[model samples]
Target: MASEHLHAISADWLKSLEVASSTGDSTSFVSHFLSDGWLRDLLCFSWNFRSLSGLDKIHRFLSEVVDGKPRFEHSGLRDFKLDDHTANAPSPFKLPGPQGIEGVQGAFTFTSTKPAALGRGFFRLTQDADGKWKALTLFTDMQDLIGHEESSSDQHGLYEGRKITWEEDVEAKFRAIEADPTVLIVGGGQSGLMSAARLGRLGIRALVVEKNARVGDSWRQRTTFPKYMPKGKLANFLDSYAVDQELCVWLSSSIASTPVYNASSARWTVEVQHGDRKVIIHPKHLVLATGSGSPRIPTWNGMEEFQGALYHSDFHRDAEQSRGKRVVIVGAGNASADICEDFVAHGATEVTMVQRSATCVISSTTAEKIIFKVPFPDGTPIEELDFRYNSMPKAFVLQLQVSGGTEHVKMFDKELHDSLRKVGFRLTWESSPGSGEVGLEGFVFNRQASGTMLDVGCSKLIVEGRVKIKQGQDISHFEKDGITFKDGSKLSADVIVLATGNEPIMKTARGLLGDEITDQLSPPEVLGLDSEGEFNQVYRPSGHPGLWFASGSFEFSRPSSKHLALQILARELGLA
Candidate 1:
């Protein structure tokens, strides 16, 4: 019946879109969503983020976007039923078989009536118990820019097709050249490098400056963060750097002064210090690829705090050096778990993890399956995966995640979840509307700091009693020998590693932007949905023109860098 009844529901929804466009009858359009429906809009056609959850929000959005508009239903929708017709569909498209879908998994698409194939959308639907289809998520964004670059010479870039030798006056030629780059990128990590790669293909003049001494050293500075990023783990990300086109990364250079953008020339003056030499560059745009974790520094009560050794995660090197020492790690997030695993292997005499609240825990094996294998199976190119996954609204991912996750919990590893509970580690499952009581991989899409832990091998250590748990205790103060908890308990330690957390990127944005500029600028959120229901600020304009933020997983940053690069190129070339 769900299949039989889908056409009518689809027709009703499409008609409602028309009504909203002409008459602004939001109530009629919003009726299609479930009572507690969520609408998360990414760069879709809005050119910004917009999230409308619940009937009120849905109605408000329709009223605003569809106000007296005409023929808003740009094209007829093509239907896809998950179970019956598309049972053999590839990776993500294969609807949650009967087991994965609570009722029915359906999908549809519509193209823009605009010329030059400018607009399009992909929407996923799920049927309610009432046998009606409602859109769970909608992804609407502009098509790719297809303009070719116009160059006077056969080659571009510094020293290109030059007949000068390294022993010759190479420096003189470099200085004599006068081409102002259109973009200046800060923090030459994954996001910055990838973005430069995209901009290069479009023949845009772009420069990336990294404070580190060498390329690929950024991950090394952060405790071998990419040590686990094997080919499978990283997918096809970093393809830009691995390929022939080498996007230049200036090493050992730091931004020296506040960057000021001049609207008169549509350029930004950036003061950079390369070693002791100051280099000034004028770029039209600035991209900040700096990671967005906010650091947490805890203050213990009592005298100046007589601790042996105390520090936050920012200073943590590795656990091998702390071997045979009594180690006490605060906080039980993913870092805490990874650090604990390292400590145990390195022969830490005692490793204790403290938790102040409940956390969402998922095994690394399960996380790999959900995050990697599901969307990025072998033989599938990353371009397809990026399009398929990025094209869907976050809500759609959350929907499929809830269904698939609940099943994994029920059938997979009850022992692991049970063992953590036995050791007093509080945990929760991602619970959604009809997908049982707990959601499986749903935490990956969470908008809050929702204490979640993706366990690698630390859970085994904790369960085996190698890593002890100290639950629900805030430190009251620290004595020369040990620290006292708020509950009056004491734990002696040779060192205290605070894995509490990090400050938002905005917290440090002031140092670079200066007080006047940073003060007037609205803070960009790293996670969680924004007022327009957006989860990312990448490639999109901040409150100020010519300023942008890029932060997220490698999966997101990979494609989003391209999106941002294209927009910046359009702006500089006056193609927008």
Candidate 2:
């Protein structure tokens, strides 16, 4: 009901939890939870990502012994309180459980067993069968390491404290990194740079290897970033970020050969090609960060091939090349939509989008206002917001999206969706037809990366008939001047843009690390949810000792980079 009443209930529940936790009473601590409830721990208890479902599992996790000590007992978790600091403080929420049960969801703050670390979390309280309030879900995250906190975002004064000039200092740092980097990053895109930035802030010597000459060169060709940032602008921002963050990067460099990991020494001997020469280096940790691999181009049978130009959308920098030419974009994801709009803008003779399947499209503006505004509002510190957003488990977030949140979004964009349908554009929802998917949110968390399109302006173009839609069947084969569909129909085109997306990151890993290490990766596939509801083969352990994967959008990369860095830090200190 009232915000004050909800806050009071949440406070009471947290107080009980604090008392039980303080005394190290696992049973008493678990008594506050529903039998089937879940506890997702992130670097707070034992420096690893864990999801314990059911009271029994959670109890066992809490009671786990390592080196003759309780895993969570001495975790120094204390001083639990409602996290009123965040935008989404203690408030009323509806759990996506049976009957859409109502509950109180709140952000919380706490201190870890170690004085140098702080923790944050989220908890949902709901009435059980006996009408007694119990936790439906709980999340614990290590917020920051106190003494080793991230560097301030403010620029340093010209004459702060260094004896050497800025250039000299940078050169020295680069030399040190080149000589011996503690962590070697394979790519220099958003994920790689962000991870390097975070690791660098933690005083870790991280060297980024990029085949391109600049940090954001790869992203420059990509049209957009999360939060509606433009491609070119974001690319420049990344370049500036690498410099400002003092991240050491090796440009025009490629991993010359498959890296060899030495288990006994826990190091990798990697040969990197730098320009014309090659340098062999050994680093303790290797971060893939290699993106989603090469462009996924589906080949078709052709007698001699189409005379028209055909290329993957990765190289579709601008539609200037498509001016006065008939363009066919094969896909309905964001890339296709954007490319179609580009063609329309550049005055293509004809712009057609071949939609092979249903796409979940949402208004980008609406999403920014509704979904992002809460956790990522303006005037708030990014670190605080990152913790607040990450405190909620991704599984719980998906559940909410599936239950009614997706419908709320749909309701807001019903007019646009109806307009799209009228134009013969196919659409889908969380529970729509053939499969058990969570719609847009599912594509995000499950890493089905290309199934959703955030409508910026393309939907309007489609509705206004500026962009034509070709729905149904795959192209059977290529025609001299066009492509023939399975339905035996053909559309003439001067240019064919395949917005088919990229292969899974695992494929890249397989080629670079070989099947020996690739096959050992937990879950085998990199994208999609693991048993713990976390993305497989990324951030946390990869079922291998010193290998990690970093993937996802800028939103996920920026925040999760801290988690990934923390795990590496723990290992460096021999704590994990």
Candidate 3:
């Protein structure tokens, strides 16, 4: 369809939505949607991330009053208009509805009066049976706090009021944060660093506490880290990012005491153990930017009787150590692929991979071209990509993926997939059951976190039989020098490396925060989709006041950092 026709359709819908929302009329508001339409709000209508499905839920969300304040009025939503940006202007889109609906999709901007904030939104409009255009999905997200716009851009070199040099100015700022941090972020990896960087731009005093001695130790310390990502190069970039962003970090530090949250002051008193000394600090908010959990090690009978070196993939840094040794890796994810390839590359005698489940395999080369090239092409500003990628609702993205995205992946990797399957590597397009996600794209969206490998060089070795495969049986037990399968087959090995992934983030949080606090968390889990099909907890509210979770890969981390910072700023300003 013509772009101008789509623009007119979007403008008309925007007008109706604005009139209904501005008047705070629930019935009129929901009249613009299909019965099963979705509304996703991020720090706009509420101080948290929420996805409401169906007209009933949307009506309740728009009409309900809490604390004697109508939720719609509390949002103070007004002035809805189509975004004028060329890239995000109204265009055609398709959804995988029962009828395979085609629709007009566009970016929009709005004003939030209650908090004095600006908001951005995206919507998909399709014709109802009566020929009236109704919304299939609408996404609203806070763009920026009015008075607290990000100020990370370069400024004049002149020291306006301070007589001291730039170094002295930054040092003083860092010291102030060290003494009285407004936000404390645990973990110094990309998630934490990005959060701190975003928070810093908003003039928030944020400190990153790293258990390691350096910024990127999380990647560097992993022995079976993927070779496609240059560890040293990324580590250097992280160190540079921390310095360039002026992020305050405490290296070789850890939480010494379980944090105590005082609701009265909305602050957390945490004890930091730096080397041998313990320092107590109080921060208004605590951000857990930690990943899912520690390396998962499955237990089998007679594990203690094994005499040879047996460890998780975390400890296998040097492939030379496996030279002339028969090694068995117990997983089929990226880590396992890397470890198996390392063993074969280093001339390990009979390196075998024990696959207990189907895996999602895609060619790394093809993935680079299909996935990263378009959205993240060279020379495009990252900030633009960040906004573009995140503006669409998760469920909408899933529809696109299921409709044709998976087919595209299958088409591109057909040859590589055929070769791997011919050699007995089982492939799957679906995520774990009940995840409600499909295909390779779904595996990533749900953060299945493992059981998928983007084949770099590992598939070639597996196809050539340099890396042997053992499949279709559960591990019965561990023998003195090897592993025994349920089929009574045994693979003799000098070393057994369990490359299984980590436990859920909630398990790790339970260990750190205890059941009392962790149990109070909403959605009941992390790293997966909630009932509303949105990521649970990460970069959003944790149900516990003054606590937040910041996680996901670099792509998610970059834009979400701003959202996290905005939430923190809103709380500090009493806008929530």
TM-score of each: 0.76, 0.91, 0.91
Kindly report which residue stretches of model 2 are placed more than 4 angstroms away from their true locations once superposed.
1-8, 74-76, 79-105, 114-116, 127-133, 144-162, 224-227, 430-437
Residue 347 alpha-carbon offset, candidate 1, angstroms: 1.1
Locate the minimum summed-lDDT window of 10 residues in model 2: 430-439
Model 3: per-residue Cα lDDT over 1-576, one tens digit each: 887888899999899889988887768888898887878888887777788878888888877785577788767789898986746688886543234568888888999987898888888888888999998888888989998988957543557786777677788999999999999999999999999999999999999999999888887776554545687778888999898888899999999877888989778889999767899999999999876577788888999999898988876788797789999999998889988888887889888998889888888787788677755667757866666667566766676666666666678789888998898988887786754335666777675657788888888888898987889358899989998888898999898998888887888777778777887887777778776767888898889998999988888898788999999998888877
Minimum summed lDDT over a 10-residue window in model 1 is located at 75-84
- Candidates' C-alpha lDDT: 0.62, 0.82, 0.83
- Candidate 2 residue-wise lDDT, 202-295, digit = tens: 8899999998988788878775543466777878998999998888888999999999999999999999998899999999999999887789
Candidate 2 accuracy as lDDT = 0.82
Better of 1 and 3 by TM-score: 3
lDDT of 1 at 58: 62
Which residue pairs collide, candidate 2? 75-113, 76-112, 76-113
Between 1 and 2, whose TM-score is larger? 2
Per-candidate count of clashing residue pairs (backbone under 3 Å): 11, 3, 0
Candidate structures ordered by TM-score, highest first: 3, 2, 1
What is model 1's C-alpha RMSD?
6.5
